[model samples]
Target chain A: MTLRGKAAIVSYGETPVTRARKDKGEPRLSYWEYFAWATSLALKKAGMTTKDLDGQGLAVMHPEVDHSLFLGVEVAEMLGVTSKWIITPSHGGASGCVGLAQAALAVSSGIVDRVLCVIGDAPMTYGDTMMLTEHRRDFEKPFGVMGPTSLFALVMRRHMEQYGTKVEHTGKIAVTQREHAVLNPDAVFKERFTMEDYLNSRMIAEPIRLLDTVMRVNGGSAFIVTKTEEAKRWTDKPVYLLGYGECNNYHHGSKALSDATLMGIGQASREALSMAGLEPRDMNFFQPYDDFTIAVLMQIEAAGFCEVGKGGKFIEETDLSYRGSIPLNTGGGQISAGQPGLAGGNLNLVEGVRQLRGEGEGRQIQGAKAGMVTGIGAVQYGRNVGYNSVAVLGSEL
Target chain B: MSRFGVKEGGEARKPLPYITNYSQGFWEGTKAGELRIQKCNACSHKQWIPKAACEECGSIDLSWIKSGGKGKVYSYSIIRHVVMNSMAFEKEIPYALALIDLDDGVRVVGQVVECKPEDVKIGMEVEAFFEDIGGASIFKFRPRR
Candidate 1:
């Protein structure tokens, strides 16, 4: 009943990260087109055709988007692939790992052999700003608590008050990740900025400066999951899914605000690592979601990399670059590599698979056998994130 | 309406609330200059933004109770940039939006008035105040001196 060493990711693919087509003067591709581009690349990498996919998992860009454009069945029909099993995980940022876990279960349970998990979006053409204004409480919208920036700023402010965290503490993350981005050709931001630049950046929301936020880009990412035994037939290096756990701390029936400092990643990581029979120290690299730098800090603390409320010190003392003791976001993460709507959530997972598969050309961690990736989902009424999903990947079973 | 910003001329075009059946009581209470939240009669657990059933103990028997309108600031953010296209908040840049932990054990989000954004701090005592904007009573908070 466990996912440990049962299913393995054989291939990962993604379109080049870029500005929206409308912004870059290119013909805009519909969501389905982008999905196909990424899917085709993954299938090619796996040395398989459309006929090999018997299971599919997809995630819509946002809950407010039209169902016709984001449904799993619609995507299947558009791609001309019939699947025995289909699922549309709607966990927002956590959809990437959550979908992977679901697909692993399907593959392990003998329901399907290969499952293609893909997500893509055209935020620029589809009025992405409107999606931010939807699904909030009746009282929160009136006060301009609309987007993740403002909501995450609230969490950052609380962390500062409780733990004496400074702008410099969070700034270190941006600085370190940007250094990693310099080595990544696919990253949107190639040029590097110093800590002074980050500290001096204009404030988008108090405690969260302009540099602390993620820029929305246009792209898609995908991967194929199959049984570990069958994976050997496709590729020489197959990244195994060791363990995964997902949790929703605050929902309709729960309290509006939990401790903003300690997110649900704590429990999710505990379950994931326990299932894998591993600990934080066993991870060669960490790919905690970076929708905001504070999120990464919270995940680092919640995932047991460091003590709660000591994230500021952890960032200050640790070397997070590719060659550091604890490498992080070696592909620059969403902070430096532009966030491409829901697809941005998959960046960490894709990078983890590549590093484990020995495909990291320049930024590969030496002998990286195991890695961890985490995702944070929807913001709940500017109080806290609703979902947390964590997964552990290893080079071998 | 009580102005929180230094520069003032245009009417605030903040997005208004679309009241739902579960939230009508809360909005009605704001208009009447009272802070009302839901209290589970079975478990005595209080909650904000009225709900059909109690979040704690899953009891259907709930009652509306008027809160004391006084609490300490749990956390806050100063919005320096106005990203929303709404012109209503154009002049209200650099405002402090706070999460106030109500004395009734419920948290409410509102703008802090009568003080500069930098002056607001966590755990600062605050009291609720209402402003009638275009026939809608909007709730805000002011630092307690």
Candidate 2:
């Protein structure tokens, strides 16, 4: 079903994501506290309050966090309104975008309007207990694959073997994002980097240098979705979701080719673009997943931004240094913005909304209109190829 | 230990178990000095990295076909460094990581033991040898013996 002219994201909000947490002295707020503040900010930005929310949803990685009751109940109770729908779509990073699609469906179908989607967490303090790792208690969690980093490292090695891409080429992508992040004060990494810094960094996994991986940060981001007509009452700049698509493949198998390439994202992006009546070239900006530099390259290539095996070349030609030719990660992405796992994709979505609204701070893309956001979740160590969710956001409203 | 190049009269290697899965049978056969792979009867799918069912089809009907364990190297990498807490790989620096394409159209990834890293090459014929790693028996490749 094409959301062709039906619904749009009127406003998006995120709390300041800095190294030192944002909290008042007396008693520091918990992760949930930050989530509540961010959710309120998003609703307020859209010229509404929790009072306008008739539906609530959460996208998170931890199942034990009681995410449903935590965010859903709190938002509902704060608004003093009972919600008919409570959605908690948990699938790692992709959960945020997936939850957005689900919420959009609810809004479009008249199940309820004004759905608030939230994903936030404090990984630094509780991620070990909160995260699902190879050493964790899950049945297939062992197998020596620690987290997304190690798993992606394995895939990077395989891709290198097949495509003959040099490790230095992969470093270029990371270095470029670092350069972009340097310009974004809200970004965790504010220092400029040379390509040499990336290449000289310690190798975490073969072909995956320290600069290639994302740091775990404590943060949360949120969005407010309502019908287009209702959204127009709130904000003039409404980024409409033209299309939504998602797909997955077997994640746990050892087949190097299947594990390394993200065929799922490619399939989803194709369907999403087709539904939106747009093409890859029509996108003004792209917020490809940057959990790792290679991941970004893989997604870019898979989405037809460039031919397979040419992602590195695409990066070099784009002049991705600080003020790039093709501006990417204007919000510093997960690489430099501190990846809060499930909250990472929400960060991307929030930034996409900001860009479409022409309000990205420090590194806003000039006159940005059409934007694409893709989320990659559940690295290949699990039961299936990572799930991918792609959304096309445009400034048509 | 001599199979992987320790001094002629070197001390016995550490205890290890060959990872026994559905593939355990083939590993056991190799311990008895034979190389075997599973061949699916329904779809004629020859598979390495053994499984209970054919990946192409859900058929559990498979037969263990003895292989010469000889094949061409499909790809390779040489590790020149080690990270912290890797004592088990202490003396194996500059080791070769290779993928071997069996004549039966299946490929397996493992280190090529008993050969210098520089000597490894794509399309070079190699055979398998069982190596013990932290009490786990792993299949490693070597220049055809």
Q: Per-candidate TM vs. native? A: 0.94, 0.77
Error of 1 at A14 (Å): 0.2
- Which candidate has the highest TM-score of all? 1
Evaluate all candidate structures by whole-model CA lDDT and list the values in order.
Answer: 0.81, 0.66
TM-score of 2: 0.77
State the lDDT at A153 in candidate 1: 90
Candidate 1 lDDT over residue span A1-397, tens digit each: 6789999999888998666665557766666777888888998998988877744443323322333633777778877777788888777888889888988998888888878988876665465333343335356666656367878999899999899888998899999899888888899998899999999999888899988888877788889888788998999999999988887864433374456666788888998999899999999999988999998888899899999999999999999988888899999999998888788889999999989988888898999999899988877653668889999999978
The runs of at least 3 residues in candidate 1 whose Cα sits more than 4 Å from the true structure, single-residue gaps closed, are: A21-24, A54-70, A129-137, A250-257, B1-12, B85-87
Model 2 reproduces a share of the real contacts of: 0.00
Model 2 docking tier (incorrect/acceptable/medium/high): incorrect
Checking candidate 1 for backbone clashes, the offending pairs are: B13-B88
**Per-residue alpha-carbon lDDT of model 1 for B75-133, expressed as tens digits?**
99998877634446657777898888888788888889899999999999999988875
Task: Give the alpha carbon lDDT tens digit for every residue of B6-66 in model 2.
Answer: 4366543332333545756765666666667788899877776566788678799988887
**How far is A87's C-alpha from truth in model 2 (Å)?**
2.9
Query: Could you list the chain B TM-scores for each candidate?
Result: 0.85, 0.75
